[model samples]
Structures are given as structure tokens and as C-alpha cells.
Target: MAKETLLTYLDEQIEKKLADFDVAIDWDTRNHTIEVIVRLYAENTNHMAIDDREGVRSEEEIIEFEDAILLYDDQKAVFDEDDYLAVIPFAGKKGMQQKVIDALIMYLPEILVKGQDDLLDFLVSDEESIFELHFSPDYFQALQADMTTAKQERFLPYPSY
Candidate 1:
């Protein structure tokens, strides 16, 4: 079997899982980090959106709305989070790296099956793992830098799907 970095492996896995959506990925091998951005470039369907008819919110109405929606759901990224690059750093114990890798493998398919998730949480993995998710300017600098990249790939939408 050929060995690959977590980013490389996950990139291939995500490429396959999100075949229906567009994905952009880049990695900084020097930093052992991977950055991914998922774009929902879905074509608008014929179905029109309907309003709930509950307009003009008061504090109580806002609270009720908040109660109804899950803002930080780990199963789906906040609408804005998907627009920004989600960086997953893999550097530490081999076993933990594998675990994080495993999680990433499972995550992309979950998103496809459900079409969304608590995606921002990948920025931090606590005591149970070695990965860390960071959105710092420095990381972005490295990712954007012309010299630090080890691998990058993009998957465009399927022509018919």
C-alpha cells in the first residue's frame, strides 16, 4: 500500500465523496495542515422558496427563532463557515493522526448523504486527538504562499448530477 499524508488521503477521499459539489483544497506540508473550502454552487431549482409568514422579530421572536434553529450543529457548517477555508492540522501521534484521518474520511460522506454538518468544529479536536483546526492569518499566509504547498486539488460538479 502506498502511504500518504492525511491531507493527501483526505483530499482523494473528499474528491470521491463530494463528486456532486465543488471543492477546493490546498495543503501546507511544512505546517502539516490542510485547508478545504466547499462551495454550494447548486443550480436553483424550479421550486420557489416560501416565507414562514412570521416577520418582524421582537426579542422573544428572535429567541424563539434561535430555539428552532441549530446554529452550531456539528453535523453541518454554519452558512458562512463553508465560504471560508476550514483548516485541519495533522501533526502528532501516528494513531491519533489515523483517527483524525478516519474522522475526515467519514465526515465528507456524511455531508454528501445529508448535504451538510458541524463543519467548523474540525478546527479543534481536544484530548481525544492530535489534530487542530485553525483559521489564523498566519496559516492562510502559508497556504497562500507560493512555496509552502505540498499538494492542491479541485473537484468541479458532475456534468449531469
Candidate 2:
């Protein structure tokens, strides 16, 4: 199957699975990856309708949690830190599309509700799984912010200055 075909299938499946949420899927040709962005609005309120000074004033706010799922061909020639997670090995393989779809259906909802850390833990524990997980700089920042402890330790060691 062609890459475009795979992308279309993924889009359709993701849309169906996450019908309640706002979803956006993009195929990154340069990186050979599909980026899925899911957004869930927790709160949406419009407190005010009109005001004299502000013309059309309104206290409208939406609290949304936007998460991403990066799916890339694991059998790529070159590898990078940013390109690890949700491995879709379509290289000389059949029935890989269904496997990918199954993985997405199982994990996407958890990622939406429990956040990225849950997936990180799962990928770390399941070494035999096709999916690979690596922490990015943004992930570390989010992890640190989510931590409740007073002391925050660095996930990766840094050199002394």
C-alpha cells in the first residue's frame, strides 16, 4: 500500500475513534511521520454578551487540553530522539496497517485521559512491543510541572559547568 493510502486510513480510523473530540491529522513528508493532534475542551463559558465601552464584549473562555500522537515508520534509515513513539513498520510488511490501527484505538483514549506520562511508562515496560518511546525536552518540562514533590530531579544528567 502507498503512504497516502495509509495516511487516509489512519485519518478515518482516528476520526471514528475520537468522534467526540476535535482531531487534526497531518502527514510530515520530510520526516516521514504522521502527526495526530487531539483537543478536548474541559470548560467553555460565555459570561458576558455585550458592553457599552467594548462594543461587543464577552467573557468567553475555553480550557482545552491538546495532545499529540506521532506515528513514524520505525524501519527508517535515519533515527532521531523526536521520531520515537508509535512505530508503524510498513517496510516490506503486510497487515501492518491493522496492527497500527489497533494500537491507536487502545492507546489514544488513554493518552487523551491519562496524558503522555502513562504511555511513556507503558512503552518503557513493554520492551518487546513494536512501539518505541523516548522523552523529548517538552516531555521533561511537562513532567516536572506535573510533579507534586518540592524537589524536582533532572531526568537526564547534564555536564558540570
Candidate 3:
């Protein structure tokens, strides 16, 4: 299949897995590569909104949520923006943490690509299924909203085994 066709397949497969969340995929035809971005989130079901703000939840929960977004390769593991902050505190730097976080966010797409290459190879060999989309923008958006609103609803059902 051509690159675009392959992307469609991957996107559909990812959506199936993330039916409850949002996902976005960017395909770079020039490089014959795809960048997948997913936002995993929970909602704030509390009856009252906090001073017009969304709500609140533990930062640790966010870390756990991101950690659960698994890929076939370890290199493609999901990263939590907050969890990375801990390392900076341990390093005793204030502004340094932001820099580190910025670096990770900037290169996240490339990191995912490394993991996807292996996954694509496996899927091609398997022949049982064809994966389409490489990323979920909606998922990423939800996560972004979650961070911005600081509201917590329900945990995302863990990715299937």
C-alpha cells in the first residue's frame, strides 16, 4: 500500500483502541513517515466547577496515565510532561526543568517514529492486520485540556492487553 493508504489504516486501528479518547496523526509524505500524538485524559465529574476553573487531580495520576500508553517498542513509550519535571527538582534547577520539558515535547514525534518503525515492520510480517494512523490529535488535545483545566473525571480504561 502507498504511504497515505497506510496512514489511513493506522489511524483507524488507533481510534478503535482509543474509542473513548481523541487522537491526531500527522503524515510527512516527503519523509515517508508518520507522527502520532495522543492525548489521554479523565473528566472532572464533580457537581461543582471550581471558581470557573475545571477542577483538580493529582499530578501523579497524570504520570500514570501517560505511562500506560504503550507501544510495541519501549522507545515509543508515552511520556508525561509533569513526571519529567521531577528530575529537574531532584537536580535542584528551576528554569532547567522547563527547558528539559520543552526538549521532550519538541522531539516527541521523532521518538514515536522510532517505535512505530518496528511496529509497522511487525504488522507487515503478521499479515493478520493492517495498521493505519500513526497518531491521535484528539487524544493529545484532551490531554492538553486536562493539563490546562486541571480537572479530573474518570481514568481512561487501560489499553487492551
Candidate 4:
């Protein structure tokens, strides 16, 4: 199949995975080689929106939401303009955690490419495609919301870790 078709296939598969959330695939239009990841996020930015004036922020609200963030627009006195996605304290709700896990599970049995020499090489190699989009595709990677815990664990092998 064509690459565009495959990307569409990726979207189509993710679209059908759940009923409550949206999965957006941000393709690396610049690199176009060995750069592919599917990112699924909940529409929490709007839900987590506080008023134009500063309002109370819950500890849970501060932790669970991590997509777009409230930017301190100097021109205005409020922090409603969110152009950042920062990683602060990351302890989320059980349901939010489960949704993230479900999305990962929905795509775990597949890869974007095949013929990986090893885990490290597979992680580093540039990509072209040759695998089942639903099964184990040849070259691809995936990301979802709330992977901070997983990311922290993955870096535990480093000296600085």
C-alpha cells in the first residue's frame, strides 16, 4: 500500500479504538525518514480551563492535565493562552491512567517497520515501511498521553538516571 494510505490506515485503526477520546498522528513532515509516531490525547485542555481571571486550581487538576498549558500572556494579566505542554508533577487519576494504558494496548502488537537488528538499533534506526499496520508493521513508533512514568523508568539505565 502507499505511504499516505498507510498513514490513513493508522488513523483509521486508532479512530476505532475507543469512544471517548481522539487520537492524532503527528507525522514528521520535515524528516519523512524513520520518524513516525501516533499520539492519542484526551480533550482535557478545555475541560481543565480556569476562568480568565485566576481561579482555584486543584492538586489533582494540576497533576492530571499535561497537554497544552496556561501561558502567562504578559500583554494580558491572565494565564489562559496555553502554548506549552510541560511536564510537572505527574500523578493522574485512575481512569485517566487506564485510558492511556488502553490506547497503548490497542497498538502494542504492531511495529512501524521490520528487520530490526536489536532493541537499541530498532530504537535508533531511520525508517521505511514494511509491516502489517494492524499487526507488526516494519517501521514505526507510537506515543500517547501520560507516558511520563514509562519514560522515567526507561531512563533508569543511564548513569545520570
Candidate 5:
């Protein structure tokens, strides 16, 4: 199918089920193949309250917004000289990489994106099949190595819901 056809199909599908997610994808036509820029907005949960005789502010801290650049069947010049994708500005903090990947894998079944099944298989294992996603980055190898050491040396158990 032509790229335009595919793009239209995806847009319609996402629009139909827009309530499922809080993110959106924008297509870039200037490139040759099907390329898209993904963006996710950070949630704001700010509120003010009066305590005794004073006012206090409480809100969820904004860690960072989730974002990525994707290419379908094409790997053009998306990366810069520093190995960061020009389109995807935020690579996220090192500690939060796994969490971000997990979110991506958990939402892999969405029909709007291509290669859903393949990404599902790679990102998730049987036990964590429900909430795991893999990030395909040039530095993934080194990160994984460090992650393994961290997991082994400083791992702690937490109750799983």
C-alpha cells in the first residue's frame, strides 16, 4: 500500500480510539518513507489547599514527557552526530529508561502503529508480557550491560500489583 493510504488508515484508527491513550502522533512527509514523530504530554495534578491557618501547594512533579521518532522499513538520517535522534529530543534519564520502555511495550497492541506484533514479542517476556517494551537505541547494548549489573548488585523486591 502507498504511504498516504497507510497514514490515512492509521489516523482514522487512532481518532476512533483516542480515549485509550493520552498521546498523539504527527506524520512527517518531508522524508522518503513512512516516518512519524510521537509525543506524549505530561500530566498536571496541581491543587491548592488551606491547612489550619496557612495555604499549601501540592502537585505531582513533572519528571519528563515521553516522546519518540519512528521509521517504517526505513532508517534514514534521524540520528545526529551525538547519536541522538534529531526528531526525538528527549532520550530520558538513564534511571527512567526501563520505565519508559515498559510503557511503550504495554501499549504495543494499539492498531494505529505498524509492527505491533513484532515489537510485542521483542519487548515483553512471558511473566512481564503485560507491561514491557524494548527501546531500539544504538546505546542499548551498553545500557543493558549497566542495567544488568545494577539489577544484580542493588536489586530490591517490591510488591507487584
Candidate 6:
């Protein structure tokens, strides 16, 4: 199926680009989106008091911190012609895959850094959605602002209406 192929390709790409993180992809039927869950292996240091009579102890625990990125292909929703966020042209399977790759390359670093938080709060924060990809607008804007002319041309030269 197309979904399986996309998931497999995404997994392979993630492994190549982000070997330190573990990724799992699944279809969210209710939301009509593919949820890619990424987990980072990290150490958690905790200081705990046992009891009034007992002494305190410091414990180091290894944990996998998880966050999810959602991708949706909503062919039905209409987009304005000049919308800069409308970069992904879901014309066909191959096109979709390439666009997703571009997005992943652009955003994954920030996502990984955000995931380093203990509560994994970044996933729950409100973010802008383009082609159903949820991302922080401020972060995206900063990325755009920081890009060189060549990098901008390379990254933003997607098919436009």
C-alpha cells in the first residue's frame, strides 16, 4: 500500500539522518494523519528522599523521551494560490515523499532539541500547520530568516500554483 511504502521510506530516511533517535510511524485513522513518533534515549537524574529516618539518594535512570510529528494528505481542502506554507504539492506519491523529506530536513533538528525537555512539552504546544505538518511558526520564520540565499532557493523551490 502507499501508506506502508511512505512509512518505510520515512523510517529509512530518519535512520540515515537521525540515527540517535528511534522512530515509529502509524496511521491515525480518526485524525486522517500519519503520526511519526520519535524517541530520544536520555538519562534522567533524580534526587529522592526515602523516609524521615533514611537518607536521600540520587538515581540515574535511562529513558526514551517521545514526541510526535503529524503528516496529513488532505486532498479535499482548498489552499490559496500564494500561500508560502503550501509548499508540498501532493501531485503524486513521489512528489509527496520528496516534499516530506524537505520538511523533515528543515525541522527535525529543532524538534530533537525541543524533545530534550523532561516533560516533552513541545509536542503539546500550539503550532502552525501546513500540508497538515504541525510546526512552530516562530521557529520556521527564524529558520527562513537565518537561511542563506542559496539554501533558501534550494529548500523553498517547491512547485507552486
Q: Clashes per prediction?
A: 7, 0, 24, 10, 0, 0
| Backbone clash total, candidate 6 | 0
TM-score of 4: 0.25
Per-model TM-score on C-alpha atoms: 0.36, 0.46, 0.25, 0.25, 0.32, 0.46
> Please, what are the lDDT tens digits per residue for candidate 2 over residues 103-125?
56545565565544443333335
Candidate that beats the other on TM-score, 4 or 5, i.e. the better one? 5
Screening candidate 5 with a backbone cut-off below 3 angstroms (N, C-alpha, C), the clashing residue pairs are none
lDDT of 3 by residue, 20-65 (tens): 4444665433332244545433332332122211235332312112
Residue 77, model 5: Cα distance from true site in angstroms: 5.8
Residue pairs clashing in model 2 are: none
The CA-based lDDT of model 3 is what? 0.33
lDDT against the true structure, per candidate, is 0.35, 0.47, 0.33, 0.28, 0.33, 0.46
In model 1, which runs have C-alpha deviations exceeding 4 angstroms? 1-3, 29-32, 44-87, 92-96, 112-161
Candidate 1 achieves a global lDDT of 0.35
Q: How close is candidate 2 to the true structure, as a TM-score?
A: 0.46
Give me the displacement of residue 40 in model 2, in angstroms: 2.4
Instruction: Summing lDDT over every window of 10 consecutive residues in candidate 3, give the lowest-scoring window.
Output: 85-94
Q: List, residue by residue over 1-161, the lDDT tens digit for candidate 1.
A: 64464445656776776676555565433333335554432221322222322544222211111101111213322244433334333223221233443444445443433332221221122332221122344533443343322233322111110
Model 5 gets an lDDT of 0.33
Task: Please tell me which model should have the higher TM-score, number 3 or number 5.
Answer: 5
